[model samples]
Target: MTDKASPGYADIAAHYRRLIEDGSLRPGDSLPPMSQVKEEFGVSITTVNRAYRLLKDEGVTTPRPGAGTVVSERLQVASTGAARLARIARTGEKYAPGETSVDHIAHLRSCHDPQVAEILGIEVGDEVIVRRRVFVRDGKPAVAAFSMIHSRALADVPELLQPQPFDRFWQEIYTERTGHVTTKSPERRTARLASSDELALLSVQAPENAAVPVLVLVNVFHDDQGPLEVWEDVYAPGLWQVEGEKP
Candidate 1:
């Protein structure tokens, strides 16, 4: 730990990161129990929990129900843009012309969602360039996505507004126009009920009971400086798998 006192969750997360980097801890190693950490760090259980969640979000640790939190086999010490681009590339060029795939539609919209607004550091209803698309695999809709970019960021590149959906990778377009490639891919995966828009986009009949839990991929694209784009992707249940190398 540094001379500065570790105060809150951020401090606790940094402290753990340092331990991992200094070889004080290794991958697959279990962290001390929450009670132990609280005693050692002199922080509350909630603070310790927050720190653990932060590590989990950064892919540094995994929580086991009875065993406690363990260092993840895969530790992403730093955000590298290459990893995300490579993952996208590995998806392969499977979509062909006349494949009955979803189309990208351009629409006038405002960024109002609290989370999105916070990521963009802008107020609600701020104008943003919104691109909507659906992913159809094997003739069935498997995913739906809505990406929002600050209009001012891509204002000069009017060609980005083309009607052809998914024709141009948004990351590539931004990199070419701004000379700043997106390097950070922070993803949030969660399950939730399908909204009316999602139901319409997926072309699925709405169930009378609770909507099935779907995986939502919210990726925030950022450079070393800050965020560039925020994408909200909704995936059908059991339709996709995410695999990454452990190094």
Candidate 2:
């Protein structure tokens, strides 16, 4: 199977799937890293990544930095969900002169995050507007976040979910509709252990062993009328530093 002409990520994914089915690759068996896979299969790094991503999506493997990728112990692929949003930006101690804008929306298929569910005031499987993004610092993944707004609030704005994840600009749409603006003010901050879902998305290895601390930010958006929106929990640590200016 390794001796093939121009194998794609799907092909590599199949090979790994077969290994798992045949018992050659069992749960907890660490698969070769991208470097090794490239050497063995003579494929590009991107191809290897796609293969790994497929395995990851199928609940077959988990990537661990320095330790390589391994078959999931339970073989049950946990939803990555908003765990990626828990990352913090490590640079930019001071805000830039211009306003920073990120116009993107991650569609929430079915989120089970307890905090997320509570913030959006929806059931575990209820549909919501999930937005995930990584604020980069110097071109490196810095702050990773998962944000969800009540589906009811977004149902009328179907165009928000078209063409791409970040289809409609959130601030513009909100202000135009109700003369409100989304404000980000940290109400509280705390630390916690990174979950399995977070470990996978952030590509963190030995998260438990490393004792990585996550900073959770609760940002609220409001209008002159009242509280317009609330992001109950946004988590990150080691990836960002906070700064403020006096008016």
Candidate 3:
């Protein structure tokens, strides 16, 4: 049993969180292993696991595929929808907070998922183009977005097939390429537990006997012709929102 005065998981998690925030620990920095941390803190491995899990949940640290858990390369920042749109309008880039992305991915794939097809206003089993991107802030995986475009759109905007970030927001690219201006983008929000693949992608783990929940934001872009694309953004858990104080 841990001594009554011994440090707990929160203490450990906070210690690392502060270090990462203060630049004492830089991005891609490895955190001490459970065994080492257990010895230093005089706690069991379980305690260390809990602490690490907490840090992951908060996006302070992330699990690298071949490497162990390390300080996240980005941190998530939450802003109003209007604010996000304004940023995208002024800067052609989305995510990276304006930094060059090292992991932007775009690909063409067929869609058999009915949910995705309905959102795109197409029949089930229709083929679509998928663009996958992981948005990082401060150094953590903030959001993973999958943009599904109908194959027909590619005849006009072939740039969507490129495996990288576009010079401008994709919607703008669509308009300039096909003159199909985006009239509205309606979004739906939901939450669900992360899957095994998601856990790895987000670089976070769930607590013992429980799974991490992700906020799913699905946006369907539409123009005069009809639905253009469906963007599904999966947000990591424990995202922080900035609030303005009343005078």
Candidate 4:
């Protein structure tokens, strides 16, 4: 373990990296016990320590006096951006559920985007139900997303308008409406500097990394009939992991 970036150490570090990226290992989530990880990876404690040290140096995970190694509270988006958001969308995901609350919900009828109209198989300007909400973490805006549901596709499933967890409830509605499992989807994420309007919307207060930038993500869930929903999300700087897996 003389070299912290040795092959074994890198391999171990990479494993944990994937878990964090996929949103499977969320912020403040503890890494497995050293003994457990050693047995699983068939590596010595020195190698594990080296790997853990590397993660800490990169600011992906942190070493706590009593908590061992925990994932960083500052969001770590996977370089493969859309997958992370898709993971959350499919599972109603949250990093710190106790501290995360959805609020400022605005439901409106509009056909705002031509791309959305095409995806939902509606004529441009056809009405759609747009649900906009903000996810606040520690009383600050972390994520803001707009869920545009095709009015025709959402036909009869008014439950989406309620306050329940959207993932499971939406699945139930999908099965009830189409008599089949919900369709799979594709997602894309683009990183950019946070604009004034976005900054105001996020209402950022003392960001962890002032240099960190924002990311715009487009997620679409569709089937034969049309897209069930189209999501455009804005992830505030220092609060999301949009940087790719390379470094």
Candidate 5:
């Protein structure tokens, strides 16, 4: 869940993302040189330049005259994930219908992405449902989210899919219908630029602030039944705040 992208430049960007995520690379940390990457990955200067450009475009790195591409000192949103969600909910945006402006759409279970598989603790081709949505506030795209519910948990609750789709949260509906106590909720946060998929889901134009920052807050809601829902939200620039935690 770090900056890990696909292969090639994506791989390189992922490496930096992991470094930052793991606290190995902090804000103002100098990334390795192109020559070093050339020596390490045995790629051409052009390829390294492309990778660096991608990171720069993603606002993970910035170029300076005296210094090279150093990590940008961004606003670190270090608050607890629940705290952030509670803050949003307190703003009258719980993301529920009538309570908030969100385009909620549910998709059939897919097993193409490894991240999805890993998140749901299922095989690569197993069945899992995803909810894709974009939350609008003040008529502007404020948040984009994807919530995955393992189909195994829904096998007994077939009514959840019927009657023109439930308007409430999946977790709430599940607990209400089955009386499952959703106990554990552990979460973490990360920052990255909105990808094309995220942008399309949120239906937003690109990069108004020279850097399109997305604050990703991922939380897994669970009970005795193991993870019931794995939800990840990517927040737009203004609607999300960034702060640091005391050590």
Candidate 6:
């Protein structure tokens, strides 16, 4: 009402945000150079900088050393399409395009952790198969996913012991192997200070041993038999959920 016609830095930020959400500007896609943006928007360089900073803080963009400000890899879900994001949120499925697992580890491990035991519907000391992966986009780590399956299911899903990620979704592999489709996948979300290990794995930037906030998303997958497996995903900083269904 005051001055709708006068474009401001917020307008600049919103323009790029829309492009990112709508898949026009995807993960690792660089934004227009500051000078070019300033010329197109008829704004000062300072104004353009402010807008870029705003986008960066919103996790919509990241500044690369030589590539300029590019879309954040974790936000690839936004660029992939909101419906796809919703689908992934509703059902644990494949990662967005361009997101790849850069590291994978699978092993049989003793499970004495109470929460892990409860999620897997196993005793505190029961052994479990643990599969871990570090997913990245544009060579930057975005999420660390840990999957735990009860040891008894090993015979049914021996692939869980494989060192590499399956060509198909793990959920699909499990379903095909056991004839138990996922009936329920309850998720629990929490925020906590990133651990030293998480900071290193997720490439979180922080002062030496300083606390950095992170979001932990845990999904307990259930089938007709009972709890099938549990996935604990840790997202890097700036990967928190935001409002708006689109993007």
The number of clashing residue pairs in each candidate reads 1, 16, 8, 3, 1, 0
RMSD of each: 11.4, 17.3, 12.9, 6.6, 13.8, 8.1
lDDT string for model 5 (93-129, tens) is 3332212345666656667778757867888887777
Per-model TM-score on C-alpha atoms: 0.57, 0.46, 0.61, 0.66, 0.53, 0.63
What tens digits encode model 4's per-residue C-alpha lDDT throughout 1-247?
A: 3444345878888777767765678889999988788777778899888889878877788888899999988644323334444445545554333244465453556685787888777888777777666666546776776778878655667766654446543655677766755554656777777656567778865565454477777777765565677887888666534333242
Q: What's model 1's overall lDDT? A: 0.65
- Please list all clashing residue pairs in model 4, or write none if there are none: 76-241, 77-241, 79-244
Better candidate by TM-score, 1 or 4:
4
Residue range with the least summed lDDT across 10 consecutive positions in model 6: 76-85
Candidate 2: regions farther than 4 A off: 1-105, 162-169, 178-186, 207-211, 222-240, 245-247
Evaluate model 4: give its TM-score. 0.66
Over 4 Å off in model 5, which ranges? 1-99, 159-168, 207-213, 242-247
The list of candidate 1 runs beyond 4 A from truth reads: 1-100, 208-210, 238-240, 244-247
Candidate 1 residue pairs in backbone clash: 81-183
Candidate 2 lDDT tens digits, 92-168: 11212111223334564776777767655667887766666544322333345555666655644555444244333
lDDT of 5: 0.62
Quote the lDDT for 129 in model 5: 72
- lDDT for 175 in candidate 2 is 68
Global lDDT scores for all candidate models: 0.65, 0.54, 0.69, 0.66, 0.62, 0.72
Task: Rate residue 189 of model 2 by lDDT.
Answer: 55
lDDT of 1 by residue, 1-247 (tens): 3335657877777667655543467777888887888877777999999988988877778987776898776453332123234424644333321123476787657777888888877789887778777766446676777777766665756654664654546667767767876665545667788787787787767666656676676778775457767877776655533332222
Location of the lowest summed lDDT over 10 successive residues in candidate 4: 76-85
Model 3, stretches more than 4 Å misplaced? 1-76, 79-83, 91-102, 207-210, 241-247
